[model samples]
Target: MGMQTTPMIEMDFAVIKEDFSRYLIHDGAILKVKIVVKKILRTAELTAQGYPAGTSIDSVNAVAAIVPQALKREPSKEPWDPRRDVGEEVKFEPQEEKWQEYMTTEGYRILIKPVLTKVFRYNKYNDYGEPIYSAVIQSITNIEKLGTTATT
Candidate 1:
């Protein structure tokens, strides 16, 4: 019997983008990036012309015509609930202890929070029977907001 050994695979990766400045900090070095979550998709669907049984094809056949279909989801309206505690959180910002100091005399606050932008809707469902959403905070921007802001 011969001893079998697995072959090593050499993997090389690169970040191809128009600009990579945001990823670098003061020292012109890449910032520490943490991958919080990783997901692997195992499900996929294929849409092609359905060829029924007893369908014959020529070896030198012509190019198959591809068709496109449009799919849309109906927007849901809020149910008539007079006493709804809270609807849903569209954006989340973390506050610091000195958040109060950022407030101006006219009750305007200028605090530094991550600029969140919704990437896309996730496929997961929540307890409220609604589709879970996800977002990404790429960079920080200055924003002057009026009125009191909730801190938690």
Candidate 2:
């Protein structure tokens, strides 16, 4: 018999909201911030994924492999304020190359690709005494940033 392959299914999603945050790295010497675009799966895709009707399933593109540089920075002595240190809104848009791209108001650009990961509930076991696994779009991989790199 020939090998079986799962059919590809298109995922329909809608942008729900966006959030930004700043973090200190390298012993507080380097500052980083990233835009988290929240998206919810539509009815069709949700049903295809075996979710019940009216089930709310949300995902974000900010869960990437590489973190983006902060568009704005504050003095180390000053407490970090997200409103002032995170900079402008960044929009994540899908590209034809199968990679997602977003541009900061400062003209910096970041590229990322979606990754599907399987998660198992260790606490919950199946009748066969095996861990139950489910696939989820919880992160993105292969992140690349273009434009003037920030050093702050």
Candidate 3:
């Protein structure tokens, strides 16, 4: 039999949680943020996708492009030590845009377009000693924010 391909799927999601972390580096602070979102599957879409009725999914990580705002540098508080001197205080913020407006709200909505690809395993095997193959989300594209309530 020929190889079967997974169909492209698009889904709506609601941002449930957001976490941010900053790491001090020589140039500036590297800001990393993680966002958790839950799929908001509609009845019509679920039926179209051949999913059974009353199907539900748990929260999953959201992958999107995050453009940080302008970087600002400030004098170090403890300048006694040479390594501690220089640009020690860095402020990083998300840019004011449609995709980023969710950062200022308790909860927001988004649409995700994901591409799937097959992953080949070298050493991983199943209980039957057969090579395990799985479909993986390679990349997320065309992330759009929904609703006008988040704009204001």
Candidate 4:
């Protein structure tokens, strides 16, 4: 299905300035400069990417472009942290000693204790003829839950 599009609303800045001045000021067409700036900022923010075909150009477009430009020019990621995340999945093959230790460790008690099932799948033989038991552990945390929080 195609995305839905909305027709843009045309605005007259001269009428906006007159109405704002009338509503706010008792003497003259004078609004607090900050308030005027904020109104312009909010209108541009909300109406951004909605300026349809035949929409008259104004300083609002210049204001709107600033947001995307600032986003694009955000400081690049640190060289050391390429992935920006350390969450790695739990794979059972090539299981180290700590892997089996964590299976029954107090840290994972809630997940391991609730299901209380550990079914092993023999994937392949190791170099020294030792069997590789890919332990299909029944735990919700096995996928992306590591290093987030400890059950214990």
Candidate 5:
């Protein structure tokens, strides 16, 4: 007869910042300012990847139990904390742009860009061997700046 092993659970969360701001400077002077306003969303999920068929409800509950704690554990608030963040991925997109007479008076136009960044760290290790190695399947999303502000 074959032996059965307890299913393993993996949990992770994403940090979403819909609103943020940055600065735009020209000739050491402020031109215009941009403000971002959105909801901050944080989400998490738990799963047992290799669980066999007919898995008991209790097993699922057990896995879900850790979600609360995981959700509460927000990735380090410090955006560049080396201890927690290993690397980063950045994406920039022009969401909208407008050139108004009022804005032109300020000597610059208002440009709003959506910036999405993903921060992550290696969680799984290959083995305790000479050269340590790790891998990651899903990464945590970190929203930092939503908009830019500059004065002229």
Candidate 6:
């Protein structure tokens, strides 16, 4: 993939009342900009249909809709355990050709670690009565956060 380049964006807004300068910044070339939004969502109508109560809220639980549901995990023997450590990894006849081919087939960049870690919860009511866990992937989006900076 090619490297990414920054873009020049123009922001236009009207003055609601006053305090206009704080919203805009005049610079040499507008090198960097950080937007501080009052809120992502605009207020719904002050009134609903009849007596105009006020813009109370559009949503009850914000995080409930966005935050991913916790993934369940089934218990399993981990690949690596300190207690079960095999006395120092014994060297075997190196598969040089196969090793090189594997590395080439799957580039290092494609083997990066996962962004989110898995959570495991133990349960003791299965057939054998040991511990078991079930897990699944979850997506993260729609987060409220500070704006980012730009470089030009």
Give the winner by TM-score: 5 or 6: 5
Weakest ten-residue segment in model 5 by summed lDDT: 57-66
Off by over 4 Å in 1: 1-110, 141-152
TM-score of every candidate: 0.21, 0.23, 0.22, 0.16, 0.19, 0.16
Q: Give the per-residue lDDT of model 6 (tens digit) for 23-99.
A: 11111111111122221121222233221122111111111011112322343445334344332221112111110
> For candidate 2, which ten residues in a row score worst on lDDT?
24-33
Ranking the candidates on lDDT from highest down gives: 2, 3, 1, 5, 4, 6
**Candidate 2 Cα RMSD (Å):** 20.3
Best of the candidates, TM-score? 2
Model 1: per-residue lDDT, tens digit, 55-129?
A: 111111111111111212333344433243233434322222111113334232323223333223333333444
Instruction: Show model 6 residue runs off by greater than 4 Å.
Output: 1-102, 105-109, 115-128, 137-152
**Of models 2 and 5, which has the larger TM-score?**
2
RMSD of each: 27.0, 20.3, 18.6, 30.0, 22.9, 25.3
lDDT of 3 by residue, 1-152 (tens): 99974343334443432443222222232323333444433232333323423323334433322222333223223323323323223223332212221221312243332332322222233333332222233323222233433354
Model 4, CA-based lDDT:
0.22
- What local lDDT does model 2 show for residue 25? 26
Candidate 2 clash pair list: none
lDDT tens digits, residue span 1-152, model 4: 99965544433322112111111111111111111111111122232323222322222100000111211222323322323423222222211111111211212211111111222313233333322222122222121122534365
Candidate 2 lDDT, 28-119, residue by residue in tens? 21211233444322233324423323322233434212222332222244433433443322222222123455443322233444433322
Clashes of each: 0, 0, 0, 0, 7, 10
